[model samples]
Target: MDYLPLAQALADQLHADGIPEHIASLFRRVPRHAFLPDVMWGDGRTRYDRAEDPDGWMRAAYSDQPLTTQVDDGAEGGPGIATSSSSAPSVMARMLTAARIEPGHRVMEIGTGTGYHAALLCELVGDIRVTTIEIDQEVADRAHSALIAEDYAPELVTADAEKLASIGDGRHHRIIATCQVAEIPEAWLVQLHARGRLITPWAPTPGAPAGVLAVLEDCGGDVQGRFEGSLAFMWARGQRRGGHMVPDVDAVPDRITHADGDPRTLLDGETGLLMSLLVPGWAHGMAMEPGASEPHVWAVSTRCGSWARMHPDGRVEQFGPRRLAEEFAGALTWWRGEGRPTVDDFGLTVTADGCRSVWLREPRAELWTLHAADHDDADDVG
Candidate 1:
């Protein structure tokens, strides 16, 4: 039932991911299993209890993969969606390295899912210098208990991350998030210390399960940065992904047209990610009938209740106040004209006054301004 070797093996695996020496040492010092819940499982709630299956439990507990620890916001689970988890150790190491945390740096983390990363931060810095905020009370309480069990106590607060400014007093040297946010909040920027860094997953729209990780530094009066990696994390509860609005173009006699372009072809790879960027408040989903040859790519905009369906044969159906099909086609065209920049080519600029804009190539060439939260019926340029 010994777990040190297993924990060390996990640390070794993370080290292979190119984590720097100082950061790697911190991860190696903390026992990962100590932060896990009584039961461990995959995305699905398949419990692996340590007492019942010691070998299997230790294996899962130290495998360097995310362990789903809470479901339905910790509402006594019975086949509900997993809401939070301990991020995979490898990804955590990468994020920590990207953060470039220095000794005696004040660190604050959003979404302390299991307090594992917070504990790692405490190991790197000191417990008094670390502050973590979690939205779910039950999840935060569980993480608190786990932290205490390991004799590693950091300040744990249960509150919405959106209210971070009111809760997270004082400047932070480094800020990171365990959850994904649709847009980088102005609150995070205001609280970040001068030259401080904030690393979090930035999803283009609400409810997106996967997004590119952003490593931003406070640049004088603004916070700007670029995308580095991709990971899947739960969306911020208040900012939960829901930008999609189905267009009733067919239900009502609106407009049906044959499009010169196929979305499936245009939005094939990185272009799909670009489409979300070019057009704000819009989401793209693809589906096919049972046993169909190809799927129809649908673009739903919360902006004007507009919708476009690009069929496999390339016919496009559109409806609502705006012509989303044309919007998508145009966006794809502009993106290609820019030499088809990948996600890494993208950057963000958030001014001190809370004005946020995403740019391509450089900040001066501003692309779009992201509102703090998803509001109803915004204009549709997409």
Candidate 2:
């Protein structure tokens, strides 16, 4: 029944990962089970219930992996699709450490989720200094209930994280987002105080499946920081494909344009990271068919109804209004020109004049300013 030993075990992993001792100390104190729901999306995409499997539930609660708490914005239940989850403990350690939370610091957490991290934040910086925002009411209600039950009452606001800084009157010394963001919203910049740090997972594009961690430090209204590491949190619900993404990979192509290029190189690892950053609105994936010589590499546009695929022979096929394969070629050429920069060779800078830019080598001499994601899934939405 005791989870401290389990919590300590998780903390030990964080220590090994080089998470600071103070952060590990807080990880040791918080009981993760209290913040989790009775039912969680478990391994193999199945539900783990406390009543049916109490022992299994405790094991999962204290385990190192993420446990999904909501699916399809909580509209559809069971293990269909995960829209939210308690982040893995190791990631929590890194983000919390990167946040640099200190005494008297006001911290704003963008996505409250189960409030597990918010509770940890409260324990670190005091309840009065923490403000957490959640979009889903049922999820927020549950988190609120849990926090209250534990006697940690930091401000809980149920609203879209993108819209909060608009009405926020107070400045935050530290701002951490659990959700994945495509472009850093202007509001997040407004709420961040000078010398504050805004830590978030900036996905090239995927409703927060996984992406590099950006640790931007505030100087006046502008922020200067680089990608610190990788994180795999759920994307904010509003930013989800129409609020969360569900790609139509197997859908019959509307049209196929024969192109010549090898897109297989851009679908899986570090190079995939580059593809995402270079070409903003498309989601890339791989499907291995049984008895096939090579896996099918696929890319679908999150906007404009475009798709691209590369067969084993290096022949490329593109569908819809845009030639996604050609876009891939351009991106590849750009990356090659840049010396095939790794994810580490990148960083982001937001100027006080309110211009947001992505950079290479350093924050100055801005590389490009990302535009607002075109959520025009009008053709794909059914």
Candidate 3:
């Protein structure tokens, strides 16, 4: 249970991972083992373990990483799933980098899973300037007690972070959410100070693998931004339900045309990356589940009655009882024509009431908007 050596090794790993010097120093100083629970799982063993054990808890605590503590809590069968967790160190670092936190800056963080990130923030900036919110009361209380034990306390609010504007006085310099949002919540944009940055994982369309990191800018009243990187996170509270049912491909219409294309090419291609770069709004890439035995496939809800299947030999088959295959084909065609830009090509612009993402290309400059005041309306632009 040697803590110092564990911390030193974690610091070394983070440095090698490109974490900044000042931030790495903060990791070095923080007592990560103190933030974890006394009885925890490690190396396949579930028991009362010492937090400072180098090959045990300390490795997980100090490494720029995430660890799962709970799955489905309060579900029909005890904890239903690993619905929430402490984020990975590298992922948190990427988020902090995207957040661009500065000394003395007022920061608000959503989804205080294990309070590890909050502790990191408290170490980076004094606790007074940091505010963290969590929805689960039990989790929040646990995090609160853990932070208190380490003497690194920040304002921990047991509430939904999407409603941050209700608890905070005014705007904050930076706002970050570890949870994935289907769309940018308006409360976030409204509570952000001018020029402030909001970073969150934008959930993928219905059946996509992971979400995208959206970096938004707050102008007077509007907030605008684009996807920066690919990330996989648990869906935010509101988006975590009702969509787990498997889609029925056979129930769809059969108006789609079988075309010749590489299935692996479509799955592993740069189409999604390019679309996000060229088109400012949310974009996705999907393939049909290969066969009953092959589990890869592409289908868009917009073409609910249709689906496209990629074969092992670089061939594509579009079949369904309905005929939205044209739309699917067109969308794919459009994505291919757009030069396949990556997430870095998008930029954000914010205004007093809303935000917009504009593609910097010529002729047909594409744009998408989200409005802050109309967030509750679901369809409001930011």
Using TM-score as the measure, which candidate wins? 1
In candidate 3, stretches whose alpha carbon ends up further than 4 angstroms from where it belongs are: 38-54, 74-80, 204-206, 241-246, 264-291, 302-339, 348-364, 367-382
Between candidates 1 and 3, the one scoring higher on lDDT is 1
Q: Which candidate model has the greater lDDT, 2 or 3?
A: 2
Can you write out model 3's per-residue Cα lDDT over 218-238, one digit (the tens) per residue?
755766666676787877886
Each prediction's RMSD over C-alphas, in Å, is: 3.3, 5.1, 4.8
Most accurate candidate by lDDT: 2
- Against the true structure, candidate 2 has what lDDT? 0.76
lDDT per residue as tens, model 1, 4-73: 7877777776677677777777666888878887787763456888888888887888777778887776
What shift in Å separates residue 14 of candidate 1 from its native position after superposition? 2.4
Candidates' C-alpha lDDT: 0.75, 0.76, 0.63
- TM-score of model 1 relative to the true fold? 0.86
Residue 95, model 2: lDDT of 90
Model 3, residue 297: C-alpha shift (Å): 1.4
